[model samples]
Target chain A: MEFCATWTCPGPDGPIHEHAAAFDRGRERRVLIVPALFEEQNRTRRLLVETMRRLDAAGLDSFLPDLPGCNESPQDFAHQSLHAWRRAMADATAQFAATQVLAVRGGALVFPAHLPGHVLEPVKGASLLRHLLRARVISGREAGEQLTIEGLLDQGREHGLILAGYRFNPAMIAGLEGALPAHEGQRTILLSELGGGAALWTRAEPGEDAAQAAALARIVAA
Target chain B: MSALASDDTDDRLRAILRDVLGLNADTVASFDADTALFGAIPELDSMAVAGLLTEIEDRFGIVIDDDDIDGEVLETYGNLLAFTAARLG
Candidate 1:
């Protein structure tokens, strides 16, 4: 598979540029990956690369774009919003015929409002965090020290902090906070301690089972 | 009993917050149980809010049902702490 260098996408403001790669095979699924936010993007980079490679070997052509304002892209930090980022991904997805657009981590939340043939992957953003927390714990980290979503409010406690990249604005945060996942912790959550954070949400666990089968089991068996 | 609970809760909360927001220990040291969050810090967005909840559930071994609360509860630092304590207790 021949991977191209960086490229640009058409945008209303200007060209939404990114570190672009493209590979062609015998008419396989065309996929686009919306990367995670802030530093999570860095930690998950290797897993993502491997995922793209797997897709390539599976004969699926895919596009992984460094959204504007991130990595080697053109959008400035302050100007990057969920809406604009969604648009950039939308533009890339439209280029595909019947290819699937899959998003990982926080990027999952940025899926287009009308997701046609979009594979959410494992789950959504909130569950990704939950899975990540577990992955880190099970891999061996201090069980007592992981951070969480509701715990972030800190009403009784003030002046807590953590290091992060990306300028996360309120509108974006509000939208994110509103989403609640069907499930949180998984096998990775328990073993996450030894593994740090990356081993969770993004780490590929191979198990084939039909989602519809599980749901129907509840209804049909019941 | 009061002092022990206070110390433990404060320490636990500080560590949790520090890790969640990517804040340094010193920054959390300056925080009490009553600081404003949400608009106060640019990083505390809805996405972070949701991520924070997942972390809390995993670390504290608590189950925060999808229907337990809404995003507004996470809009401030103090509110979040109270919510956690309530659930933990």
Candidate 2:
């Protein structure tokens, strides 16, 4: 049972629109899924979609809410901040009355502290930023441009620079660089893969891993 | 672990390559101890390297320092298995 859902978040400027793919059973044990950051989010989208489908089969409802300025939201990425994204997640949890959360990759960075949930492949913001910067450099070189991490950050500081196809504002860059996920949460599960599979996010194209998605659903359902 | 045990470990590592690196099962199935990773596989670039390390750390319950990462550790299937086994031991 899938449906499109929307939640309104009170942003500093005005109301922010948040969108989601909901797997609803109207059951008591609903889980909110917070996906990975930026490029990772797009890469892991299929998995999240599949996970939601499987979760419905497993008799548990879940919501895959898009962070503000991402996915189908009307908000602009140029102004999106780590704190706003975090608040949006919390808002989704409350709007859905979700009891648990399942965070993927850098999603843990924005996961609410009070909600009990599972974390899959938790990553620090600094590490994520470093990888993004590396990819930006590679792409820049491939495009015959001499782009450096320092230079990119400097540009971002002045105005939002599009890096790896995502706009990173000065505030967003600074917040993401320094932001760390709070460990004092109701975190109950930690899931990571053990075998050889490509990191889909780094791929030039989007890819899917049914096996990985199935494994995650099974863990969350348990 | 005996030679046979080491062989088993190698097989498992290959599966990890297939799962975490998102390599095709058939492609990874042909990989042996001599199969070059890291620089050899196009998917195993800098970003994938970080993902691979995180996957390895989580799966094996071992911590890998950023400084410890060099070209040698991920050179081949055997090298990765040996590195993991050493940390496990």
Candidate 3:
């Protein structure tokens, strides 16, 4: 569990160094893991880390990088756009010399399309945005304020509204509205394929499933 | 919808609830039409409802309008299953 500087993002100040959770021993098969975005990232982090450990035991090296606005990065979450994240991922892929890629959920939207790998449960950006908007609406109802998804989206498009606690800029919201996971050279692994009860990304809270982790690792290893 | 199709929707809805709420297989299997959902189940919070609706749309290949959503729709297990079946039609 080494925290190593994996890539650099061009910042207003200067080049910003970004770190990653790396399980590297200079193995032959190196994989760059592009994680799910926002709140889903939190729910699936433990599962991804567990999978990384399994991959390590199987003699494979993996690196899960912190995107510009995520994790330990110094960048503002509201300032991050999908385009910037894509560039950051491309930088990580090159810096790590990743031989393959493993994109999880919304991660597929930004993963380097040239690299051949696997995409687990690839989701459309529209769906991701809808989830966030719906959550905000539900929360508003609880607070005795009426809110609608369309109404919130309209607001988000102009001034950028906070959804599910994440500050999303107009560019980020617009980018997400049209983002879709690339599937050309990647194998799409569905939840049914993993034989899981339900995906951790959809869970109400952060949870771990060793069986699910092992299933994913096995697919990646094989 | 045919009887077979309705049964399929019922099964899928159950599976979605189990997966989204992190409910056990047996617990979900035992859920009947009368079982309360949104209020009764601790795991099925408002946030979970968002994920649940998304999953339902994805799995059933149905687009659910926000106007169609209401407390009554999600009040019981049977209501959700029936709503999903109607969408699939």
Candidate 4:
């Protein structure tokens, strides 16, 4: 079952309340799930939720927290930064008392180092930005916007640019472009189709792969 | 015909193709140098290309500079394998 919870963290404006969903097993072993960013998050949310259920079944508690300006959070995306998100993840870890982390894609950029966990498909910020730019360019062309990704990126640097319905500030873009996946723990899981059906995040719409969730649950439990 | 890679490099490239493209084992097993990749396979889109490059770099311990990416490098299964094998050398 999904239990909604919130974590308050200091932000540039004031206190930001970040929402999280806790998959409760009433047990002590807990895992915090840091999700992929932007559209990727929407695409993989179902798999993450399913994995949380599997974790609950395996007698493990899991928490999926939304960073500022994401999910149910009302914070402005324009004000969000990698630094603030890193802090948010840390706060969630302490608030939920999580002992392990399960991060996917760009989430690895902000993963807490002290906790032992699995990181799947860890990506660099520059690589992520490139992909995001490609997507925006393609969509822009389809919409007849006559916008180039280079132009958009330059505009973002000058002020902010809205990509795929999400507004990105210059600071956030710079922070994300410089961020790289960080994990000191030995347990790292690369992308595979063994437990997952495919890379659902590449799909155009929200997708789910139960096998992927099962694979993730098994790894985290192990 | 082009130069052939060692059985090991060929095997690893095949596995990488299967894993990154999410292809079935049978499909990957039958694939050869002549097999078209980027444009032929619908799943090998721009986004999938990023995932493929990241996976290749991770599994093969290679660093694919942005300049290394081009139409010729990703043209076929053979082209990708040779690029990777050359990197390994």
Error of 4 at B28 (Å): 17
Using TM-score as the measure, which candidate wins?
3
Number of the predicted model whose lDDT against the real structure is largest: 3
lDDT of 4 by residue, A1-222 (tens): 558777787777777777898876658899999999887888889989999889988999999999788888888777888887888899999988998998888898887878988887787887778767765654454456665667878988789777667888898888877898897773778656445355766554466677788888998898
Q: Rank by DockQ, descending?
A: 3, 2, 4, 1
Residue A194, model 4: Cα distance from true site in angstroms? 3.4
lDDT of 1 by residue, A85-197 (tens): 77777776675442555555466556543543332232444444344333333222123444443454231124322224344454444444455322222111121222332
The C-alpha RMSD in Å for every predicted model, in order, reads: 13.2, 5.6, 2.9, 5.3
> What's the residue-level lDDT of B45 in candidate 3?
78
Better of 1 and 4 by DockQ: 4
Model 3 / residue B1 / CA error / Å: 18
- Candidate 3 structure quality by residue, lDDT tens digits, A1-222: 464646787876888888899998998999899999998888999999999999999999999998888888888998899999999899899988999999999999999888888999988999899899997887677677789989999999999999877899999999999998886878988877766446899988889988888899999988
Specify the poorest-scoring 10-residue window by lDDT in model 3 chain B.
B1-10
User: Against the correct fold, how does model 4 do in TM-score?
Assistant: 0.71
Worst 10 residues of 4 chain A by lDDT: A134-143
Report iRMS values in order. 13.2, 5.4, 1.5, 5.3
lDDT of each: 0.52, 0.76, 0.87, 0.78
Estimate, for each residue in A119-212, the C-alpha lDDT of model 2 and write its tens digit.
8767788777866775566555545677776887778778867765788988888887887766465444444442344556545346887877
Runs in model 2 deviating more than 4 A are A11-13, A188-199, A202-204, B1-89
Angstrom error of the Cα, residue A151, model 2: value is 2.9
